[model samples]
Structures are given as structure tokens and as C-alpha cells.
Target: MLFEDEKTNSEIAKMLHIGETTFYKWKNNPKFIKAQHEYAVYQFDSALPLAVKTLIEILKYGKSDKVRLQAAQIIFKRAGLFSDNGNPELDKAKQRKAIA
Candidate 1:
């Protein structure tokens, strides 16, 4: 019901002849809340491929360096090429210093 239809909570409750408070109370349950979060993640995962493709296009043909750099940063981050401090070079330098 939540995924198939984009109805509001009040609408869903009304259709089931329940009150708004009842709807909210049920929605606030831990399991129900988890399902909602999982469904949202599922929707985003389904669209992620298209989003990645568009970001690639922006990186390749963006009108300005600022825009292209931003896109490139996102791609790098998603590709697991970033370090904890967000700078791969800095991370390498730190590793070398620690070795020394």
C-alpha cells in the first residue's frame, strides 16, 4: 500500500476508515518505520544507475570546471576512491609519515 500508491497518511487512514491518530500510531511502530525506510532505499537504489549515468555526462561535458569537478568528486566518492579525511593524497602522505 505504501509503495504502490503515493497516498498521504490521512488518505490511507480514511480509506481504511481509521482516524489520523490511529494512522500515526501505526506508522510510528518500529517495524513499520523500518519498512518505510527500506522501501525508500529500494526506490533510490533503483534510480541510482540513471543518476550515475547523468553524473558521468555532467563530468564529461560540464560547461564549467566547478561543475565538472563537483561531479567528478561525487563519482570518486561513490567508487570508494576517497580516504577518511576526504583527500587520497593526504592519506597516502600520512601513511608514509607513519611508516617513517
Candidate 2:
């Protein structure tokens, strides 16, 4: 509830019938932090397939060329083929091609 809930800490605390200080203590606890991290990972994992599908749909069917390009860039960046610092794998591939 602490994670998936959109309510503020105070509001959630009120709903949970706990004091604000207690809520803060729980929120700051190591176990709570770990649980939050795991929950977030699960949520992201569950959404990943749909997220990829949406990105593909956008890349293929976006109304504007700019939007389609942005989606393609996102896909490439996530796949490690595009990066601001340049990809070493890509450089290695180019070097191999040069040798060939």
C-alpha cells in the first residue's frame, strides 16, 4: 500500500490509523526499503512487454516523423545500440568490418 498507493504519507497514515512518526519510521526501515524495491521491480517487469509493444506501435504508426524517430531511438538506446557516450560494441563491429 505504501508503494502502489497514490496517497500522501500523511493521508495513508490516517487511513492506516497510524501516527505520522510511526509511518515515517516504517518508511525509513531497511526491510521496507527492500520491499519497495522488489515491488517496483515486479511492477516494471510486468509492464515491460506492454511497454515494448507500445513503443513498437509508436515507431511504426506515429503521426509525425519526429515522434517515430524518438520511439526508434528509445528502442535502440534500450537495446544498447545507441548511447550518448558511443557504444564500444558498435565500434568493434566497425573495426571488424574495416578488417574484412
Candidate 3:
């Protein structure tokens, strides 16, 4: 139900009859963040726009490359197949050669 048409935290809080502060506290919990990330990916695969919104939400609070990688993977998987030719992960040297 997290991916329902109304996906904002405020909207969810209202639907669940919880205060915004409670919702924020829940979102800050590690367990809740992990679960929410997984649910967001599932919703993304189901073509829910809220999934993308959720990913962005998670990214905003993420503090590590691991989290960013997870977000990137979700985006890549949903967008299309990728190849090394245009890989954005490459170093500057690789990018210059590719550009040349």
C-alpha cells in the first residue's frame, strides 16, 4: 500500500492516522528505511511512479556509496539494459578515451 497513488509521507501519515513527526521517526529507523527501499523497488517494477519518487527519497537520506549503488541499480533496471561502452562508472581516463 506504500506505493498507492498518494505516496507522500504526509499523505501516508494522514491515511494511517499518524502525526508527521511519527512518520518521520519511522522513516529514520534503519529497519523501516530498508523495508521501504525494498518496497519501492518492487513498486518500481510494477510501473508505479511513486517507486521513482521513493528512490529519490531514500537517496536524499543515504550516506554511503552502497545506498547510491542500490538506487542506481534500480534506475538502470527500470530504464533499460546497459553496456560498458557508455558506462558512467568509468574513470576520467576512460571517459576521455571514449570521447576521443
Candidate 4:
């Protein structure tokens, strides 16, 4: 139930014909938590191949320069290749200085 769908605690409890407190108790069980984390990691890892493929397509054939730049930025940031996703006020200051 947890791995297959992204359901809220309440929804999952209702689906299982249980109360929310009982659901939380089961959710917080150590084995259940471990399994949950493992399942989430598996899901994330499984998606990476498709994500990389789409990112490559965007870099190569995106219609707009803005989108291609965004794709390149994603690749660079993931590679620790430096990006300025920094303080907005600092960015504005830099922009003003450039204009001046």
C-alpha cells in the first residue's frame, strides 16, 4: 500500500479499515520504517534513467533557449559544476552592479 501509492495516513488507514492512531503506530514501527525508506529509495533510483533521458532530450531539442539553459543548469548543478542558486538579494545586487 505504501509503496504503490502516495496516500496520506488517513487515506491509508481508511483503506486498511483501521484508525489513524493505529495506522501511525504501524507506520512508526522500526521494520516498517526501514521497509518504507528502502521502497522510496528503490522508487527514486528506478526513475533516474527516465529522468536522465528526458533531461538529455531537453538539452538537445528543447524549443527555447530558456529550457535548454535550465537543462544544462540541472546537469551542472548535479555535477557540482557551480551554479548561483544563491541569495536573491545578492543576485539583485549583482544585476544592479552589472547594469551600472
Candidate 5:
């Protein structure tokens, strides 16, 4: 509900017919955590640059290449580079395999 009109926590709780306590509890749920994380990214503001940077670092150094790629995609999209026409560099990179 944060997107439609940027509803607050209380508003969301009322809309979902739940108490504030219940809503807080839901915040700790794994599914809710994932959704909230995405929502936070979508609604991110300039003041959140540090948090974004931290996430990028985690993605860059994290164990999973998949996670790192996902983070890179998010960062690129947020920076307005990933467009409807797609990214040429990304396409080319995907077509080429690294020799290790």
C-alpha cells in the first residue's frame, strides 16, 4: 500500500485489518521482509544513499554470483541505465564466458 498513495504504517495496518502490534510482527516475517526490502528500494530517497551503497557492497562481495548480479541490476536500473531497449554491454557480457 506504500505505492498507491504512500500509506504509513498505521494506514496499512488499518487497511489490512490488523493491529499495530500485528503489523510489527509481520515485519519480521521472511515474506514480509523480502517485500519490504523491495518496497524500500522502490521508494528509496537521496538520504538513503549510504544504505544503497552498503547493499551494493554486500552484493559485490557476497558469496553468490546470482545475488551480486541481482544487486548490480537493481543499481543499474535505479541509475536509469537499464531501459526498455536493454543494455548492450550486459547483453554482450552475457554472451561471453570468462576463462578461469
Candidate 6:
């Protein structure tokens, strides 16, 4: 229940047959928090293929020019084409890391 997405505390508690306060208590536990983070990463990894496909689709055929450009910019940013300090030396370092 804790790993379920888009579920409110009260809703999850009801589904689990537990009190809302108990649900909150479990949510506050450190181990539970760590497990939640792991589960979220697993879920994201599982959805990554579809997410990449959607981004590519938007970059290719988005309705507005601005939207398409934004999508392209996101792709370039993720690909590390732009550097934060606008330093060519730093960009070359990153390119070398990618090649290595």
C-alpha cells in the first residue's frame, strides 16, 4: 500500500484496514522511507522506455513550435550538450568522460 502511487494516506489506510494515524506512523519510519525511495526508483526505471519514447514524440511532432523547441532543449540538456558555466573546456571534459 505504501508503494502504491497516487493514493492518499486515508485511502491507503482504509485499503490496508489500518488507521490513518498508523499509516502516518509507518510513513515516518526511516526504513519505510528508504524502501519507498527504492520502490520509486524501480517504478521510474520500469517506465523509462515509455518516457523516452514520449519525449522523442513531443520533440518530433509537438503542436506548438515553442513546445517542440522546449522538448529538443530538454533532449540536448539531458545529453549534456550545454554546460552550466558556458565553458568550452568543461564541456570538452564532459565529452571526454562520455568517450571514456
Report the number of the highest-TM-score candidate.
2
How do the residues 1-100 of candidate 3 rate in per-residue lDDT, one tens digit apiece?
5545558888889988999999889879999989988988876678767767879877666777566555765676667754435445564454355335
Evaluate model 2: give its lDDT. 0.84
TM-score of each: 0.68, 0.73, 0.39, 0.66, 0.37, 0.68
Name model 3 segments beyond 4 Å from true: 1-7, 44-83, 86-100
Which pairs of residues have clashing backbones in candidate 5? none
Q: For residue 96, what is the lDDT in candidate 5?
A: 48
lDDT of every predicted structure (CA atoms): 0.80, 0.84, 0.71, 0.84, 0.73, 0.81
lDDT (Cα) of model 5: 0.73
Predicted structure 1, TM vs. truth: 0.68
Tens-digit lDDT track of model 4 for 51-84: 9999999999999766776687688789999567
> Across residues 1-100, which tens digit of lDDT does each residue of candidate 2 receive?
7666788999999999999999999999999999999999999999999999999999899997667777877888888887756487965664455445
Instruction: Please give, for residues 75-94, the per-residue lDDT of candidate 6 as tens digits.
Output: 88889985466477965565
List the pairs of residues colliding in candidate 4: none
Clashes found in each candidate (C-alpha, N, C closer than 3 A) = 0, 0, 0, 0, 0, 0
lDDT of 5 by residue, 22-82 (tens): 9889978899889977877766764488878787797779677666666776777788986
Q: Compared with the true structure, what per-residue lDDT tens digits does model 1 show for residues 1-100?
A: 7676789877899999999998889889998999998999999999999998999999899997667766866777788985446377875565455445
Candidate 6 to truth, TM: 0.68
Candidate 5 deviant stretches above 4 angstroms: 1-47, 84-100
Tell me which residue pairs clash in candidate 3: none
Question: What stretches of model 1 exceed 4 Å from their correct place?
Answer: 1-8, 84-100
Candidate achieving higher TM-score, 3 or 4: 4
